[model samples]
Target: MKYTSYFFIFILLVAGCSDSELEPDQSIYGYEYFPLATGTYQVFEVTQTDYLNTGEVVTSDFQIRHEIAESFVSDEQETFIINRFTRANENDDWEYLNTWQSRRTEFNAIVSEENLSLLKLVFPIEAGVSWNGNSFNSLEEDTYVLDSLSFPFRLNDQGFENTITVIQADNQDFIVSLDTRFEIYAKDIGLVYKEIVNLNYCADENCLGQEIVETGIEYRQALLEYGAL
Candidate 1:
C-alpha cells in the first residue's frame, strides 16, 4: 500500500470540519424549515362550515394570505416578526385583517395575535416529540404532538414532499363535541395545511337517545401558494 501525504490528509480533514461547523448557526437552520424573514408570504384556501341551532348547516370557502410585514427587536431583547393577514372570497378584493407576531426562544416558537399568545412550534423537531402548546392559553390547555417524523405529504396537488404533521386533540368525543386541529408543515417551507373542526352538539326534543341536534362550526385552511422574498 502506498503512503498518503500529510498535506492531502490535512485538506480532507479541513473539508469535513467545515461542514460540521455549520451546526452552530441555529438561526439559519431553523429558518430553513420555518421561514420568518420579512417579505415571505403564503396563501391558503379556507373552507368553513357552520351549523345553526335551527338544524341548518352553511358552508363557505375563501382565500387567505399572510405576509411577513416587519421584523424588529423589542427593548426586552426579544425579536418579534410581524405578519399581516388578509382574506377574501373568490374573485373578490382582499380585505385587510389583523396582524400577528411571532418569536422563537430556545425551546419554543410563540405566536401572539389579538389578546392571545400561544406556542406555535417546538424546536429540534423529531418524531414522537410532544409539547404543551396551549400552556399560555387562558381558555384551555392543548398538547401538540408530532405524528409523522418524515412523511410524504401532497398539498393542492403540488406534488409530494417531505413533511411533518402535528395534531392537536387527535382523540375526540364525537358524542358531545369535536375540537380538533391538524397542522402540516413541509421541509424548507412553512405551514402547508391547517384544519380546525369545532363542533358542539346537543340533543333535540324529538331526537333519539344521544342524537345530535345543533352543531357548531368546522374550518379548514390549505396552502395555495408560497414564496420567499
Candidate 2:
C-alpha cells in the first residue's frame, strides 16, 4: 500500500473517536439518505432564487455525484472518494453531461469530532459538487469553509442565503454570472432552503423578489426533479 495511505490512516486515528463521525453536515442528507454507511449513492441538489428584475424563476443544472466509501483512519477516520461528480442538463428532456470531459463535483467533509455535515447547500460547496485540492482527507484537517461563489440573481429571494462558498470553474469557460449569494443545492430537492446568506460578491440587490410564487416545480416535473434543480 502507499506509504502516504498509511500516513493518512495515522492522521485519522489521532483525529478523534466518535459515533457520529460519518454524519452529514446537512439535515437534507437524512431526507434523502439517512443512516448513511459505506457505499455508493446519489443525491439531487436543487435551488430556486428569483429574477431580481422580473421575479422570474431560473433553475440551474443538476449535479450527479457518488459517495464512495466511508472509513475511519488513525488520525482522521473519514470517508474516501471513489468517484467524482458530473454536471448534467436535459435537452429536449434528455439528460446529458454539461461537459464532454471529467466534470466531477466533490466536497470537503466537516472537520470535527462529531464529523457532522451541517452545511450542504450550493454557494457554500455547490451541494453534490466536487472540488480541486480537496481529497478524502480534507476533512481531517481544514475547517471546510467554502468562501467564494456567486449567487444567481434569478434564483434569489429576500431571504437569500449562501450555504456554500465556491470559486466555480469548469473545463471550459462558460458562466451565467449570478451574484455571490449563490445557494448550495441538492438534486431533486430544490434549494436546501436552510442556510442562506449574502456574499461579498453579491452583484444585485434584488436577488429574489418579494412577490414569491410556489412555481409548483415538484410533482409536476419528476424528470426535472430527478434531474436536480
Candidate 3:
C-alpha cells in the first residue's frame, strides 16, 4: 500500500511540472515602443542639409507628420497605412507627401517606405541584440543593433521615461567617407528622433582626414508633437 501511495505522489509531481512547462509566457515584449492605432499621428521638425561637391552647402527646415490613416490585413497580419504630410513651417498648410506601411509581427516590426521594406525592431527588446535590417528587401544587408533599451530620453523640452536606440550603420573613414544612421523610439510615442549622415570627404593627400564633406546629405527629424487624431 505504501508503494502505491509513493507512486501516486510521484505521478502528481510529474504532472504538475509538465503543466508549468506548458504555460505560455505572459510578459511584455516591448512592442509598446511602436504602438499602432488608427488616427494616431506624430509630427516632427525636419532639417535637411545637402553638401555639394562644389563646396556649397544648402540647408532647409520643415515639419512633417505621420498619421495612421487606415489598416488592413496582409499575410495573415494587420498592417497599418501611414500617411505622410509636410509643411515649410508651423504656420504653413500641410501638403500630402507620401504613403508608407507598417506592421508588427510576433517577432519583429516592419515599415515599408518608398516600397522598400525595413525590419525596424525585434521582440523581447534587449540591449546588444542585433538583426539584419534589410532582410526583407533587396538592398545590401545591413546589421541593426539595439544600442540602448528602456532608457530615459529628452527631446525638445519633453522627457520620455522609456526609450530605445537602434543603430543602423556607423562607419567612417576620415579621409574618404562617412556614414552614420540611427533612430530613437520612445515608449507609447513611437519614433522621436532620426538622423542620417552620409558624406564623402576630400581624398587628396593634403586634405586627408580634413573632414571636408564633399557630396552627401545630412537629415534630421525630431518629434514636435503626437496624439491620436
Q: Write the per-residue lDDT of candidate 1 for residues 1-229, one digit (tens) a residue.
A: 2355877887787887866585677753344445567778888898899999788899988888787867787765455555555556657776777777777666677788766887777877777788888766786777888888567887667864677788876757766676788888777777888898877757454553463737787888888888874
Candidate 2: global Cα-lDDT? 0.33
107 in model 3: Cα distance from truth in Å? Answer: 0.5
Instruction: Answer with 1 or 3, whichever has the higher lDDT.
Output: 3
Maximum-lDDT candidate: 3
What is the C-alpha local distance difference test score of candidate 3?
Answer: 0.92
How far does residue 143 in candidate 1 sit from its true spot (Å)?
A: 1.3
Residue 139 of model 3 has an lDDT of 89
In model 3, the runs with Cα more than 4 Å from the true position are 1-27
Native-to-model Cα distance after best TM-score fit, residue 133 in candidate 3, in Å = 0.6
Order the numbered candidates by lDDT, best leading. 3, 1, 2
Clashes of each: 0, 63, 0
Ranking by TM-score: 3, 1, 2
Residue lDDT tens for model 2, 1-229 = 6999999999999677665766656544323211223453444443434334344556554544434444444444444433434455432333433211111123222221133333322222333454433333344422233343334312332232322333222212112232222223333233332222221222334634332332322111111222212
Q: Which consecutive 10 residues in model 2 have the weakest lDDT in total? A: 216-225
